[model samples]
Target: MSTSTRAGSAAPSIALNFDSIAAARAIVPRLAAISERSEQLRRLDDEAASLLRGSGLARVITPRAFAGLEMSPSAHIRACAEVAHGCAAASWVLMVCVAHDYVIGRFPEACQKEVYEGDADNLIAGALAPQGTLERTPEGWRLNGRWQFGSGCDHSPWLLMGARVANPEAGGYLTYHVVVRQSDMEIDDTWRTLGMRGTGSKDLVARNVLVPDHRAVPTYPTFIGQSPHATAPTYRLPVFAGLPCMLSGSVLGMAEAGLEAFIGHTKSRRDVTGASKSANANMQQRVAESSAEIAAARRLLESACDRFDVAWRR
Candidate 1:
């Protein structure tokens, strides 16, 4: 019955236009109409993408310094789920892109500026599995190797991925907070799947791509939620607490959609035996159980987000 998350970006102006979640909900009909087209394209349809980008949802977690709303976790869940109720792929992209803003907030301010100031309609995709390698460079770092699950890379101009740095001086380590331009990498169209096909979460391959010193930082601090924007409560929450809470929106949305669809279809259904499932006690019991499970999941997710918000406010 409740949620409070918001953030909107009107570049060059620092005003926070709240109600991105409301905007997302308002577009459900339009989004649902184009869901099939997006699914078939194996990526977001142009209209679908535009709706999300224009609705101010993508800027929800962006720092207010960057003209972003820095939306709340509960609102993030509701917004993503609302979009997913229409199209899972679009919701997936929205959550991933906006959550990156939160990640970038922890990055050095220069990196944040390069991203936010560089593009008013910027969207980012990422894979934080540490599958790639980063070599130290005089100017910055050279990225190599391939990373998996580059979701939304097809639609985004930049990517944040994980990489390994072979530091003989300080032993080996992994970095999940590296940023690279989309111009420097290849999307290996290998995202074949049974569901959520619109995600286009393919593999990303880079060869000696440049990642400027300012663009990349020690992942430890970012993961721990250390940020130059000391005044922003949203950026102060650890990535574990913040990003996952937001990203989970897409997953919960899909599950919610599944539950709704199941109930709808079951309400006017018949089995292979031509018996009415609508009148079947077994079917009724199943619906009740599934509804409870889905409801519980939603509660658990929102409760966690609320806890994070309360704790981080101090």
Candidate 2:
């Protein structure tokens, strides 16, 4: 809900200008500077949120029609990993929010347009687990429920909440993501945890919120890469396969950071015997092993992404 009416995707994104990984790297310093502040605030601070929006990293998986870069899976992974180098909480927020945009792409064109009316980089907060009910109505659907883990909701104006809809024809319930303005639901500040506090994974309560038919998207089709609005191969990559790759980037980044910290600590660390860890053969071996393992993980995750990219292209 970017109400200011400034709409334009970055100019004809060429390879170098639209490199998501580089954009993430540019914001790394700022993200690190505010890491402690974000933790203390129990959510991403204003500056960090601004940095994420300006960096354009969240648009990697967004649709091209809405000024999204629509980059490949590998690119998304690399960008998240880069952000994780500075702060894992920020990385998780970036990754989850980007995926939310991708999900928006799955909605009908009308809904996508309505959601992105103000700007293309509009952020969407989501709670994946289905815990609500949608009752049929003349105007649209009435959504009611209490959902948890609404990550990144502090910054997003739009929210995609999962709910169950009754199917009269099939006599069963189907899962749907009801798109609603963030203000439509009451946000509860219940996210308190020992780690990753900056994610702001709060709880949301919705009481008879009206969701238009176009904005309610099915879960199964999107899961199987069959978006009504998104016809491109990128959106076609079933989330069951693609989401794991997209979310894996943060873990990979955390592992890389852990490796870097170990290397830095050992460089000047002395053992109990007063022997320099850097000079000790066993410590050196451990360092090499950790470095190799991290590298291998990066390669493995990227490789999986690359394969998905290739399949989607065909």
Candidate 3:
């Protein structure tokens, strides 16, 4: 069953059945095993990328027509959290890749088909900062700029890069976005980060690449819920509004992992004075405080997801 479809397209009658969080959790062992290698490479290893793609977690926001999950935002957050429990870098990359699928759904139908057809598992990486300079051309827009923080670009075949277009009528520039094939661009290995090193969020450079008109989109419509092409309810939500929830899942997951590690260490740890850390009053208090904080963070994330789901559904 193909799961790729265009924006404003109708959802399939039968829901695509899959446990997104379960799928995420099942991959934790492999992700954990490769954490050190991923960190060392400053990017996700090819094995880890293949594992994530094969797991179907990468298609959480892809249209059902393209054999994607088309999952809700809340579900996506939950799934991301589960993935982060194994590896933060992997989870961060997943969040960007999956979210880009949703962003592409807001573009023109031709652009959607160009990326999703013949490749149901196709991944898209994106950089939303308006750093590109767009020039009008006979066929379409000519984009020439360098986009940074192109997360998961190492594994992507396409990219949605943000740019600024000179508006003759308005006397200034308008925010524009273009979708381009990765083959048409150059990748610079500049992703050196203290955290999320495995995401491979390097810089992508495009020089005078002509993006077809069908592949270009303005950011205003999507940001203000005014996209005439976006008929799906998911596309109607404000773009910036849901990003916080997407990022919070990883934070919560990391907190959970830290708490677990601390407790495990405390179980068999000795203080400077040769006392058992887990048995000491101060150590016990710290552990209790950390556990409480993690629990509180989980509740906040759940509440945020609940609110987003309710608003999007309505």
TM-score of each: 0.89, 0.89, 0.91
lDDT of each: 0.74, 0.79, 0.79
Better of 1 and 3 by TM-score: 3
Clashes of each: 1, 0, 8
Q: Which candidate order results from sorting by lDDT in descending order? A: 2, 3, 1
Instruction: Report each candidate's C-alpha RMSD, comma-separated, in the order given.
Output: 5.0, 4.1, 2.7
Q: Which stretches of candidate 3 lie above 4 Å from their native place?
A: 1-16, 168-173
| Model 2 pairs whose backbones collide | none
Candidate 2 vs 3: which has more TM-score: 3
lDDT of candidate model 3 versus the reference: 0.79
Error of 2 at 29 (Å): 1.6
Over 147-218, each residue of candidate 3 has an lDDT whose tens digit, in order, gives: 899988988999988888855333133887788999999999998879778889999998999999888887
Off by over 4 Å in 2: 1-17, 166-173, 280-282
Candidate 3 lDDT score at position 239 = 72
lDDT of 1 by residue, 84-199 (tens): 88899999888888777767766766677777773545778978777887887677788889888777887788888878885524323456468778988988999888887888
| Local accuracy of candidate 2 as per-residue lDDT tens digits, 1-314 | 23122122332243235888788999998899888998999998878888888888877777666666666666777889999999888888888888777677778877878877556676678787789888888888898999988888998888888888765343133888878999899999999999889999999999999988898877888778776666655666777776687788899998898788888887888889998889998888888898898889888997897786577555
**Which ten contiguous residues of candidate 1 have the minimum total lDDT?**
1-10
